[model samples]
Target chain A: MPDLLSPALIMIVAAMAIGPAKGHLRTAVLLLAPLITLWAIWQVPDGVQGTVKFLSYNVEPVEGSALRRLFATVFALMVFVGGLYAFRLARWYELAAAYAYAAGAIGVCFAGDLIVLFLYWELMALFSTVVVWCGGTPAARAAGIRYAIMHLLGGVVLKVGIEGVLISTGSIEIRPLLATDFSTWMILCGILINAAAPPVSAWLADAYPEASPTGSVFLSAFTTKTAVLVLILLFPGEPVLIGVGLFMVVYGIVYALLENDIRRILAYSIVNQVGFMVCAVGIGTELALNGAAAHAFAHIIYKALLFMSAGVVIYRTGKTRCTELGGLYRTMPVTTICCIIGALAISSFPLTSGFTTKSLISLAAANEQMVWVYMTLTAASAGVFLHAGIKFPWFVFFQRDSGMRPKDAPWNMAAAMIIFAALCILLGVAPQWLYPFLPYPIEYEAYTAGKVVFYLQLLLFSGLAFFILLPLMKRTETISLDVDWLWRRAAPWLLQQGSRGLQPLLVFSASTWQSLEALSKRMAVNYLGQPETADSEERGLFARSWPIGATALWIAILLSAYVFIYYTD
Target chain B: MSDSDSQDFLSRPQTIRRLWWGFSIVLALTVAAQLVIYVKGYFVVDGWFGFGAVYGFLSCLLMVLAAKALGYFLKKPADFYQQDEDDA
Candidate 1:
């Protein structure tokens, strides 16, 4: 039997009501729905709660497990905090779309079948495109179109894979599949596309920054992390993922290092951070799975905190490029402090959420004796500090005074930052709160003196490198090419050239057809032995009148030819 | 303390110098912690003295240099994609 009130349904219904609800009533629903959803999420006991047969397949809409509960809980909390941050700023439709997007994420957390999961997945794709368009700029519109196309393509790939699996196995159940056949490999490809794996990874950096400030905060929290959650559920211990994850880790850091836009830097680092979770899922140990899940949870908080701080800067200063911003700490002290805290958390400094969660993956690698993966993750940790941790706050808030004294984040925005900031520390201090929610038993401790010292040394040295290399890392108004170049520049250019190249062929074909029609008209006029009338010329080739006797003669001649050919065959 | 004085304090040269000194001390101390803490290394190279520090520094340097080299080929004006829109 289906539960009467699932957590995702509350938000979905609230999203539907937002268009009609007005003023204070809208605000109340926006704030209260997530709180209510959180309450509903907790009330759900651990099992399949909502199941129904659809199209001759049993579909379970709500499957309660610790992992699902953990993801849903955070997604609900994200909606509340993100709503609070955006309440005073965003247009009503943006808020509605964001709530619907959050609902889709929540739905994915509890989905028990491929059909139900694909439904939620498409729902997210639709609403998120609206949120991107809500930026109300030309760039946002173009980026939103590209974002939609990429996701729709991804959905088609995923749908094809799901159909393949259903046909092959005669079931719609979502289960871990070895990448042993075409169907499973297709399934893995579909999920990794959302994980921002390379070759298609440019979409995240392309679209997220074009979103309005508040839209980015919601955008940052859900999509890729949802992809990570699904990966942990479905494709654990796939060895090839280790190489893919490593490439993403290095790719993100390099692009972030070259980035000039403040949010784009953070966006690239999101790929970097998700790289850690992907690598962990690749490791596929019990500890590794726990690490991937825990890291996704921790990453959502800190990354949103980073984006919130960036949003405040953009909202106030009307600038986003790092070259155009600096010396913000003097006036915007609260934002600076909060941004620094977020930086520390992302860098995995001791006593922050990242310190508690990210180490689990590294330890899993070490335990498995995957020496190369372990060392690469260690270096990427420092590189994270270089690009995101120190570089973001240093360039945006503390470098040479840009002499702009914008006000700090307004009260609601500050409250959102403060709440996530507090969680960053609280999770670090008391990881026990988060540990029990893992898919496996917690057999690791995070706060060892030796590990702390090692990370401190690594991160601090990377910081030293940042200052030492600061001259080379100066902000510039330049964009770096990614695989998007094929579509953005090359594909359009190729199409234009292709059309230009075909012009002569088209002209020749048209003229030749015109000549053929003229010849046929002359033949008809001569053979029929009737004077050509004005109407005959006007009627064109196919519509020109011919005598019945002449047509019968032509048909008899064609029949004679056909009879001869048949006899020859 | 007055508002101007607080401003004077942060903007002062001494503040910069003091920050550098503190930075150096912290770096030294982090290096010193290698003696006090025993890190279990999964690989032979990772176990060497100050492996993480040297590796982090060198990798960061290489990354910055690589980005600089890549910028030669990949970097374009911010309005690069805007060209597509204008043509369309």
Candidate 2:
């Protein structure tokens, strides 16, 4: 009811409260904050509801739309569920940082202007880095720093673009723009970096798997999905995104296939899954936009579910590498079933949320008659089944027995995963509930007999291929090099090499400076007739005293020369 | 527990064999179902009978092989980055 009451404020305030609250009080704030935020999100009416004067511009902090509300609602839901999963086990600081991170994401959803959006974008970056650091390992500390650097670089580029747009158009209101000029292109690049688009996507796989399991569930949901939300809001129908999205699709599969870390594989598939949404946003039809939005919502749920399951395994067993894990399904039945559901959803298997939501994007491509894009997407869908759908669960849960029995997820974690797993099936079976909330009116149906048959053949055969290629898919304790290698390895190596190569030059320069100093001393001694032995303690020519008369005479000559030259010129 | 006692039903050799047969049958059924339901494809090649099955299988094969090949070049010891940490 109050003006300027953004739901982001509620979560942030609760985050502050959580830092000091203890035990039951902390639990109460963690659970209640998101519920209240969800209510506040829905309470906002359509269009811009709040604005304030800042500098010469009117800063709109709260705007409500069907799309914005959809994203915000899901974010709020994620906070509650993620909090429920983590509160019992996670450190209080992690909960606080995760809450603030969720607040930033929700803030981006309702940001009415680019300025507010950028601020929230940064808030997400700052707090998500904290969540990453909560891994409490040296690797986590390093990865968090890298993640921070990458996001901050992206934020600067985005800020520059926002400033450019403001100067050019005199308006900061969120609106669609093509990447036709410098500013829009900068904005696209900025968003793509967060979207984990190629050439810089390694950050997702690099930082995420390193975070604490509970921390990762929060990480998985916010930053990249917020990028998708902004892409939907700002740069729909950009042709370049098609190519960028396709690259991400194939890249995710290949890298994930090569990965052995359980969580890293899931992290790579996050890029892969987001690739579907990015491609949908590129397609930019009402249907494609709806697909992107719906896929993001479904992706956040299922992806978090996948991370939650992986987190439980990591929590129970200290090992993280696939080479070190198997037969988990025997002891951790609940985690296994939940992981399978998450995997099925990601694969777009029939009667799953992925099928209901992802089909819309392929349908949109087909409708537009983009045959190559359609084929690529269809194949990528199958690839998703191979790399994430079957590969993740097989290696982590059902393969050769590792002969170790670890306890399943604790009660709260189980409850969290079950809630998301149910949502996956619910949305799959009854997408009609999700359809009305999409930004566009719905005309497509997901459960056609033909579609079901087609998708089943596609995904199931991919399953067959996975089993057939089981020998080739053997896990190794290794990581694939990505673009981050340029910064992480190559750049540092180059700098080391450069310094090595410059060793002679540095020595030569030092000797040359020494000679110059000696030469100056010799010249002063020979010309001025000063005793070098007397000035030996002085060490340099400037350190010796000179006669005032000689100095004055030299100054008079230099002044005369300057006057002569000036007059002649 | 002994090996026999510890082995779960799902991991037993006989059950594994049965699972393979059952999985094969289900895969065949999915392709077979396409005969009764006419699948309209946006592209000419996709319209071919069992296109989804064949394409999906081949795509995954290519991706697996590609990843394996890439692993030769891209794969590094798990502690590769950690070695950098040591150096630092």
Candidate 3:
């Protein structure tokens, strides 16, 4: 019988085991834990399976639904494959933190209440910062601090919303919430922060590239995608998300077009890809929701594949900027071919997973008669092909030879890439294999002759445009300023100036207090013969020695006035 | 998969000429495909002949130009953020 255990808990336990289990034993646990969790996920049936009471509220730790299963299944698979890619290359603690991070993602997947989900949300934030710090460079350490602060602030915002909801509604059930009230809007804000929605979107690009190569591959799989999942659950059909998602799509492309680092380009594209899922959630039809879910699944596969390929390049050559690397294809053909496949998949080229899945989103826009939206989405599709699909491979693999002939990917890394590459094509050819795993039943057809032709023309012509505009798209060693600059530079600068400006006021106040005490003491010594007052300052009019006759007359006048007024009232 | 053939194919001027011709032919085939496959146009302008090709090409040009314009304002020295950290 399948034990009723939270799969996330199993992975968390595996993380604990890794700290002391040395050498091969540690590898076995790292590899087996995710495999075991995969089995546990499959064994879960569609309903609430495990519940516990905490603080007079029932918290369901295992809620079996199609959406939860799909997300958990992919997350589990990512941990296993990401581990395979990392085991030979990464430090043991990095693997441990990564597994714990994956566990937190899985925990959120099965969480049936807002409180439980928030806990898992925090778990991910804590451990992912460690993964970023594992990069061990000064840059990584700084980036990780920024990353943690952003997520923690997001966590606090989410907690406040949860508290408000609990007080008002007297329930913690995770259910659909429209942004009709302050609490719901707060919840939406909190979730969008994690989704890398605008204003805060820079965190994704800012920190992700600073992580170790294996750390980045794992980072690519979770966080924003999980936010996409939660959005699908909580705020489907919220019309405002349509605008937000579109902004992200265009922003990602424009920034990616400007990016120089290989991984940072991939990072910007993550926001772009997640933008499609977010837009679909706003469409909120069964077809659109399925499109969102399926696209998330397909994206995790191909994006990780792309990042894995990039990781190998970084591992062997110790370089990441596009201006410094190229012509590696001659020696690293396997890595190059795998990268092209990943590129094609991300661009939704014909007979790849992206084509099979991303079309459903465009089709959803068309079905809704959103003419402007449909046009922009179609245009962005071509832009994706330009910035990520072509730019990544062309600049990193096929551009002007930097004369660096690094070795091909090691066995483990190559194995991981090959598996994902195969899945990209396999799912494209037979999408039915993935469709059944979606949150809704699949009724839409993906492949029509017209769509195939339309996409081919769009993506191919974009490629042609890329070659034509080759001179304009020159690589430069530069970084684009993002919203994080306000906090990173402007906020710090303002704080420093404020402190420096306040210093004189503080010193003046302290000296004035000392002088007052000295005068008061002198007055006390002279008049009252108290030693404690020997340094006291002279008092004002109220503290002067007054004649008894005058004081009594004044008190009598004030008392008479009060008594007269009181009697009249 | 010999080194000479691979090198000559990518490096030679003749190969470049052939590639351009091949690319033009493929573009022509896609334009021709519009005549045979009836696209269910989602909007009024979408039904125009070779509309997808024109729109795709023009949109790409616009995106690249827009991106380049934005890059002028947004791009900074790669060490812009790092300078403060090193100072600290």
Global lDDT of each candidate: 0.89, 0.93, 0.89
- Tens digit of per-residue lDDT, candidate 2, span A1-569: 37577889999999999989998999999999999999999998899987788776799989999999999999999999999999998999999999999999999999999988999999999999999999999899999999999999999999999999888989898999999999888999999999999889999999999999899999999999999999999989988988888999999999999999999999999999899999999999999999999999999999999999999999999989999998888889999999999999999998899999999999999999999899999999999999999999998998888888999999999999999999999999999999999999998878988888888899999999999999988888788889999999999999999999999999999999999999997887765556636646444455556799999999999999999999999
Instruction: Give the number of the best model, judged by lDDT.
Output: 2
- In candidate 3, stretches whose alpha carbon ends up further than 4 angstroms from where it belongs are A1-4, A510-569, B1-8
TM-score of candidate 1 to 2 decimals: 0.91
Ten-residue region with minimum lDDT total, candidate 1 chain A: A528-537
lDDT (tens digit, per residue) of candidate 3 on A1-569: 13446789999999989889998998899889999999888887887776788788887777779999899999999998998899998998999999999999998998888988999999999999999999899889989999999999999989998888999999888888888888988888899999999889999998999999999999999999889999998998888888888999999998999999999999999999999889989888888889999999999999999999999999999999999998888889999999999999999998999999998988888899998778988899999999999999999998766778899999999999999999999989999899988998877677888878888788889888999998899989999998988998999999999989999998999999999998987776666654444444663444556799998999999999999999999
State every prediction's TM-score relative to the real structure.
Answer: 0.91, 0.91, 0.90
Candidate 2 lDDT tens digits, B1-88: 3475336798777888999999999998989987899887778778778999999999999999999998999999988878997988
Q: Report per-candidate DockQ.
A: 0.61, 0.74, 0.53
Q: How many angstroms is residue B52 displaced in model 3 relative to the true structure, after the best TM-score fit?
A: 2.1
Model 1 agreement with the true structure over A1-569: per-residue lDDT tens digits: 44734579999999998889998999899999999999989888887766687888888887788888899989999999999999999999999999999999999888888998999989999999999999899999999999999989888888898999999999888777778888788778888888899889999999999999999999998889889888887888998788888899999999999899899999999999999999999999999999999999999999999999999999999999998998889889999999999999999999999999999999899999988898899889999999999999999998877878899999999999999999999998999899998989996788877777778889998999999898898888988898899998899889999989999998999999999999986877666543556445455455567899999999999999999999999
- Which residue runs does candidate 1 get wrong by more than 4 Å? A512-569, B1-8
Residue B14 CA displacement from its true place in model 1, Å: 1.8
Model 3, docking class: medium
